[model samples]
Target: MLQLHPEQIAQRLDQLTELSVELGRGAAAGMLHGGDITPLLERIVLVAKDMTGADGGTLYRPSADGRSLEFHISINDSLGLRQGASAGVAIGVPGVALWQDDGAPNLGSVAAYAAHRRVSVNIDDVYQSGDFNFSGMRAFDGHYGYRSTSFLTVPMSDHEGELIGVLQLINAQDRETGLVKAFSATDQRFIEALAAQAAVALTNQLLLRQLEQLLESLVNLINIGIDEKSPYTGRHCQFVPELTMMLADAVHATTHGPMADFQLSENERKQLWLAGLLHDCGKITTPVHVVDKATKLETIYDRIHLVDTRFEVLLRDAEIAALKAQLASPAQADEITLALREQQALLREERDFLRHANIGGEGMSPADQERVRHIAQRRWTGPDGAERDFLDANELENLTIRFGTLTDAERKIINNHISVSIRMLEALPWPKHLQKVPEYAGGHHERMDGKGYPRGLTREQMSVPARLMAIADIFEALTACDRPYKKGKSLSESLRILGHFSLNGHIDPDLFDVFIRSKVYLAFAHKHMQPDQVDAVDEAAIPGYVP
Candidate 1:
């Protein structure tokens, strides 16, 4: 045994007191910062090891079932043990102290004693029990190689008087002889303070976990709602993410390009993908009626049917006039019959011409052109039996429509959807990576030559991603088999049209070239374009578009 001076003892006590103060301060700081509890608990072990002069220590918390206490954190010789070791609540020496009460193997003994007394337990001897008989003491004693004369266990409780955890200290040094001895009352008090601080930190950590979970659930629900709104646009939310990732990957692989700043790390790539998926989330605000509109005359109430009804009235009037003329001049019936027949034939031709013109997908032919003129020139009697013009002269001569799906006004509203998309996206509280989504998605209709509607941004003003989306949108529309307005264009025809746009500066010439050369257009065509249309393209005849 080695003797220590009074000054040395005081110094040792001061060090132990300082350890408690530092542990409490650190735990409080961590709680304030919303940090995890594991670090605080580990700090407790570190302080315990330093103060008590032990090689290691473990912190235990009760499991959900409350049947056993589990090791929440452990510090062993500057090395931490992995969570959930085989040391059960009742298998180790610490567990014996944690589970014991009144010198016997009472399962609820430790909990009852702590609750009833509201005080910590300090066991100075394990081999010889003075008042507690822990059943697992022998197993605990053997595993730790403890010929211990003294041990201390402290119950840590929160301000609400809830048991947070337990702290155990082993082998205190004897003051008189400098020999190992059981932990004293002072040691118990020191550990109790540390345990209290740990409790506060743990509570704060649990609260943070709950908040994070709530946020995640909310984001997921919003994403699901965005994905389910459109029938034809189903899987679009998912596809955008995939395509964006692919583009990002390609950009990263390039050694020289304008995309150098856009090179993304793994996490940044994931964020980009997420942003792409949510880019059109604002489309939820768009009217579903407009989204599904398949024709120029489509609206909440169609007016094209009214035009058809008017044509039918003209046909009826022509027949009625023919009958009236024949009945009124029965003596001149042969001349009248021949004249009525010719007039009836002319009216029939005019009605047929109007019908075909209204349908409008076929290319205009000479016969169709002449028929249009005849319909425009034809006259009829009004409901009041007065002569009236069927169509105005200028309307008859200037009605050169190439498509039947959308009128000039309806097309403007449809094109203005991109602006609606922008406004809708601007309303969202997007993360940094997704901040550009509104810009990219809203510019899908913009052309390179500043002819596109809404912003009419020229090529330099738009992003490459926006350009890609524009091309994809056009290509999809051209070859889609499901549109009600027109037959799907053949792949050859679609590519030729895309090439024409590329030549005219409506689309990115380089990207269009890349799309063809990389066979990406063909791949998209195969997947979404009609199979018969896909077969129409001659690969050999198609010009190389990509450098």
Candidate 2:
């Protein structure tokens, strides 16, 4: 038995009081530091050593199957050693089994005994004690030329009495004698209290990590839903977030310019990543046809085919009229046949013109639009025998669209996706660290000059992350060959357009500069762009860009 003097007891009491305060402070700090359990576990072992004057300590976490106690943390002050989970080193050793091969509690190893019994086990000296197996300890001490002494093993449990881990401290040294001695009852009591606190902290951190993983999984699920709705959009949803992070890392590494001082904490990085994944989640509500309109005259199917049938009908009618004329004037058959061939040639030319117009482009000239209008006025007899304009009102409207495949109403539907995304993200009950997710996700579509949609927020009103996302979204879209409406632009072309956008306030100039200077787009292109699409770029020629 170990006895303590009155003065020693007073000193220990003071240490205990201070240690309690330290534990509380550490737990709070751990929660803010990305809720990592490693720091907390390290602190637990260190605190236990300080309180008991132990020369070494080990923290064991039970395996998921509840069959063994694995070494999670180990520290030895005498040997100047730190290893295991907290030290970023694997133990590379098997855990102590709680049950023997026969399926009964072994109760041989001291740490396993403590965990199995859910109680503290204080030993004066392992070599002299036959109560628990000490063969491994003897072998370890022999190899290191050290003597194994006192041990105070405590079972950590949460508030509900669930086993969290087992903490074992060895060789408690005398306060004044500088010699190892048995751990006293006072030492065991204090260590038990510390272990309880550690258990609660560890449990809380583990729960927080689980919750964060759950949130990430939910975000991915939304992205998968968007992918299922449109196969082209899933890659965009994936690439934007990665590119946003790449640009963010570039800005973070920069030591000059307006973004030199910017940096992201662990929590901030996670928040931005989540925002990126959810940016286009609202596209799930978009109609598939509107999202994938490949040609100007496309709806459920290309309306150009229907127009071909009408041309065929007109050709047959012309041939029939020419034949009737030839029969009416047999002497003038050659003249009538020549006129029929000319009329057929004219109809074929007009049909080819309409076919060329049906495939949409970046822009359609006014002359082409007028030609579509003229073609629509020509007469065509349907199977119902009713003569009507060659192209109906809807077909004419779709065909004469001055830009990409979508009409004005369909463009509105596409633009509404961002608004819908904002609503969906904002409606969620987010934690304090992630509350900015809605703003970041929603701001990607907004322009720097406040000409953007949904809220018209200017650059100053938005965060750096929002601006970063805006650049990522545009760059990905510009170089994306998977889109139905446009082929992926070459690197120089994409950069030229991006540079123009930077000058026009379509995106943040500072971020655009960082994006270009860091060559972030090149990395993305190598991974996502076609081999032919990745071309050499001339930096000086890029419009509105400094470098």
Candidate 3:
């Protein structure tokens, strides 16, 4: 038997202790960062080989069905073989079966035996031992012209004593003569400790990833509900996040801007992405009719058809009066008929004018609004046999809406969605990395001058991601042609309005500048905007913009 001197034994003990410390530190750091566990697995095998002075090692994780041990990584310095270390090359070796077809544990393979028994198996030499099969190793050696010798297989288990993987090392070399030797008790103990640490780290990483995936699925579920509620808003929910990321990437890449110092880590980017997806989630609570108010006089249905019926009544009444007057005086029949024609022409002209006004276009001139009031003064007999104004109070209120289709009350209801979103998002218990989601999602509608909705937060109160979302949300709305009320504007038109907003303290000026200089709008336009809406833009012509 080969033995180490007292001094050599002491030096080996110190090295094993250091390796254990490094393994524990690495596992702890990986758990804290929530990164991939592949590196940790690779490190475990490396440490095992170092502890035993082994010339080769392989790590095996159980297959999904628990019926086989799949080769995850294999390293052989003597053979100059490195199969897996995150380089993604296929291992090319088949899995070691854990169970035979007879439904019995297959203890012939040393890795499988360790995994099934949940114990370490140390061999002085594999070619000389008959306890387990080494035929595969013999064949491998014959094919590669190498020797098959000492073997040490250890099972990795978590705290609950469930086997997670198996670590197998081969050909332990003597420190003095560089000859193959058996792994000692010290080597086995250190490897067993590392195996335990590795198992726990892998479990924690898998759990963390599962939780993150669950959160993302819930966010998507909310968006799907919103989509089923309204197709227009569903598109908005999808496009805004995409545009937000686009703008954020632009700001992150800019080196000369006011936001040059702004940077996003991987986790921070993920948080912002989730925030963008959920920004308009509160719209789900909004009344569908109010959100989809297509015309000025639209409710459950368009009330303009009722106005059309009223005009028809007036036309019939005018004809009946002409006929009665003709019957009363035969000589004045021609004059009465001519008067009837003129009256019918005037009524038709007014009716056409009202039809045009009902569209609720960009702006309503004062003269047009006054004309609607004048038309409302005409008397009409109701079905109840009482004379009433041509337009009801509600109809007058709706038709007189100066801007878009929504009235002030409906606008308030629409704006309340942001508040609802804030409440919903803030109710969730979030991790430290994602605690900013609510702030980023909720601050999209807030203004730079503190005149915005819900909280009316000023620019300084918001994060850069929040400001980026603001630009994204507004730009997507302006260029979107899917909305029921307004046609999408061209690139030049949207930029002009956005520039005005930048100067008017409606949005952050620095982000807006990045938005323009980076041409983020052009990228969004090409992807989501209509062909006609992607018009040429003159940077100098845009208002409130220096460029």
Q: What is the C-alpha local distance difference test score of each model? A: 0.60, 0.87, 0.87
Clashes of 2: 0
Consecutive 10-residue window with the lowest summed lDDT within model 2: 28-37
Question: In model 2, where do residues sit more than 4 Å from their true spots?
Answer: 1-35, 64-66, 85-93, 159-162
- TM-score-better candidate, 1 vs 3: 3
Q: 305-345, model 2: which lDDT tens digit per residue?
A: 99999999999999999999999999999999999999999
Candidates ranked, most accurate by TM-score first? 2, 3, 1
Query: Per model, how many backbone clashes are there?
Result: 9, 0, 0
Best candidate, lDDT-wise? 2
- In Å, residue 450's CA in model 1 sits off its true spot by 3.9
- Supply the TM-score for candidate 3: 0.89
Please rank every candidate by lDDT, starting with the best: 2, 3, 1
Compared to the true structure, candidate 2 yields what TM-score?
0.92
Error at 208, model 1, angstroms? 10
Best by TM-score: 2
118-163: candidate 1 lDDT, tens digit per residue: 6776665655764654544455456655444555666677667766
